[model samples]
Target: MYQKITVQTKTEVKPQTTAHLAQTMTLLNMGNGEVEEEIQKNLAENPALELDEINRCAMCGSEIAFGVLCKNCMNNQLKQDSQYLTFVSTREFPVSEEAADNEDYFEDGTVDRQTLPEYVLRQVGMELDDREKMVAASILTQLDDDGFVDVDILELASYHHIPISSVERVKGLIQHADPVGVGSKDAREALLVQVDELKRSKDIPEWTEKVISDHFHALLKKQFSEIAQQCEITINQVEKIANFITENLNPYPARSNWGDVRNPQENEMLQLGAPDIILSFFENNPQKPIMIEVFQPANSNLTLNASYHAALKTVDKETKMKMREDLEKASLFIKCLQQRTNTILRMAQVLVEIQEKYIREGDRYLKPITRAEIAKKLSVHESTISRAVSSKTIQLPNRKVYPLSVFFDRSLQIRTEIKEIVEKEKEPLNDQEIVTKLEKKGMHIARRTVAKYRDMEGILPAYQRKEKVKTK
Candidate 1:
């Protein structure tokens, strides 16, 4: 088509490869803390980018320096919590307490933010039998942070060349220990275990156990009539049982109740760093929508220095060219930062929409969602979603922090549901039976896989659970 090649001049656009590659790596891997550090480093090195004086508090979202909360926030906190009064009396209420007290603080100012395994190991110690100590330690280590058991009991037995009963016995011991439901096979099993512990007082509805045991789906669906009919009870009795389950059950037992949690100021901090995202629930609100507040680090407020952009017009040829290149690099860096945030936000919104049930109820309703599936839905590359999720932590309504990557953990969600099904089976569902049940619930997996998940969850198979029931 271009026959007149002699006079034609084409200027091709070439990307700054080194700068782009470095910028991409930074944007994808860094969480808010790292981003802030990078921003500070860039401001020092690159003459083009400058930090706009943000007259705002990063935490309270009021006006102050980027690093600390405003004076008003500090004063209001003093009026509310009497504990801070003594400290405030000695000195003027600084943006925060002095560095002397920083060591006394941990997450929520009460417990260390160690993973579930770490807590369990410390809590259990030398109490277990020597043989049991090893198996118990192994199981606790293999468990996910959520406290759902992840090692297959049978496999562990085979590997250790111990009887299956020894493994099962240790598994039961851990399950019954403090943080009562931590060692459960799944959310359902966790709920059941918690109920068993609570049932000791005998205040729980008599038929509530039956409903949870045999008619879990019906109860969940609010199918009172079906459950009532199956359990030979009136709908009124079913409602009472439903009320019991509603009041007592917790699907995600791993986290503290961020709801009604009153961690004192300075005391309320997460152990690692401030959260990148905050989710607040309004129990009083009519619509019942979660309010998501994304907190960007102070360094995200970078802009091109106006003097440099204006300097390009007045400077000499060589100097102007260099200034123009600097401006371009600055612009590229800002673009990468914005793109990172936008991708994270879009993914988070979609995840919230999909997991609203879980947010309202607890982890029990967390459906099986995968990064690949979300990547497809968002029309972005899986790697992009992965990068956006990397090293990120989210604050829940009750102010509990969780990794952004948690939304993509489908196996944990499935195992949680499976544990529920096995515990609720009228006559314990064997591995094969559980597989059939799981398929009905839209989780298609091999019988062996079902068995494996069951064993990993530390749940005894159908026959063993049945024997226990007969003994009970």
Candidate 2:
């Protein structure tokens, strides 16, 4: 008499895929020491996995010690720059033999340094209620070392099971923190924040924010006239605002001072073992192929236990099943390691291409590169580039140890370039003249940029410099 309807639902099961992804993310964020520790743990847990003696080089991919370039690659490199690319393990922790024997670690564990996020949270806590504190904490965890908002406000709200408006509200409030541009997602946003702060104190020119917000790229590219026309302002006004930004605002933050990136006690980067990837460039080659090498420590050399595999055939069904599962887990772990190597290699290859000038010439030539640019070029997410470079270091031919973040540093490098130009000049070059010289060298800097950099150097203007020279 009564009709009923049947309802059906399908549940998707992807345990293997999900587990692979979870492990991959874990490996991606791991530093060299952590990876070695993980490999040791895997060997201990998985009966089918065995540690092997690594006979081949992880660097330069040859049959030799992986710490330095093999003889064959070394000779090839010598023919070009005559500089052998060497990668060595650096101690990330300050521990003596006695400290090592004792359970007590380095002072880094108990250091008191106010990280940017911690500083921000305390400020937010002073103003916000209990509910807002929760949202602010979530936001704090996602910030990069330079104090930029690393996640989308909407996505964060959705993920945290909070309203979108709540996230946006806190984001706006956080952007007003002391650094002026601390919570920005990118350069324009940071500059805009600075501009806004200035506007609140004094009436900035109406077109100032417009030029900074819209034509920042053009500004970076040194298209001053274009920015002037677009903003419907005079070139002189553009020069004034440009000078203001250079003088009054920070274009980039020193990440080392940021609490999250540095050791809380030392306020420096973590020292780690051999670089994950070593890049040896063929300076002579027109295409400039770089040899990307992975450092293979003894602990990281993992292989399948052949003895265990052979024993599988003679075991009972339950034991054989268990062996197969362990084998699968070991294989999954190995695959994650292989993928990690490939991802690191690709990231290093991109770095070599982008920082070729820095590698071939000196630190002066290191361009203003960003993870976004690298991600765009590599067709990966920006987060991937960030994770790949987070705790890594690249050893250059000059025998200098530089963190991967050095490639992304623009302001300090540009200041160095300006100082070099002034030192090399026969006479004191005026700010306008310095700008021209920098333009010729592909810097495209504004005249205000020269004045700002010179002032930071505590060097006088052209007239003052000339007067001092005459007296000398």
TM-score of each: 0.49, 0.57
Superposed on all Cα atoms, the candidates' RMSDs to the truth, in angstroms, are: 19.1, 11.7
Local distance difference test values of all predictions, in order: 0.62, 0.64
What value of lDDT does candidate 1 attain over all alpha carbons? 0.62
On TM-score, the candidate that comes out on top is 2
Distance from true location, Cα of 331 in model 1, Å: 1.6
lDDT of 1 at 382: 56
Per-residue CA lDDT of model 1 for 101-196, tens digit only, reads 666433222223444544565666556666666677666644543567555778768755678998887777676666777777786777788788
Model 2, span 179-226: residue lDDT tens: 667777876887787788787687676577788778888887778999
* Model 1 stretches astray by more than 4 angstroms: 1-22, 55-273, 282-286, 312-316, 422-429, 439-442, 460-472
Candidate 2's C-alpha runs over 4 A off are 1-16, 54-146, 153-183, 186-274, 277-292, 310-322, 410-413, 424-442, 446-472
**Model 2: worst 10 consecutive residues (lDDT sum):** 1-10
lDDT (Cα, 0-100) at 320 in candidate 2 = 95
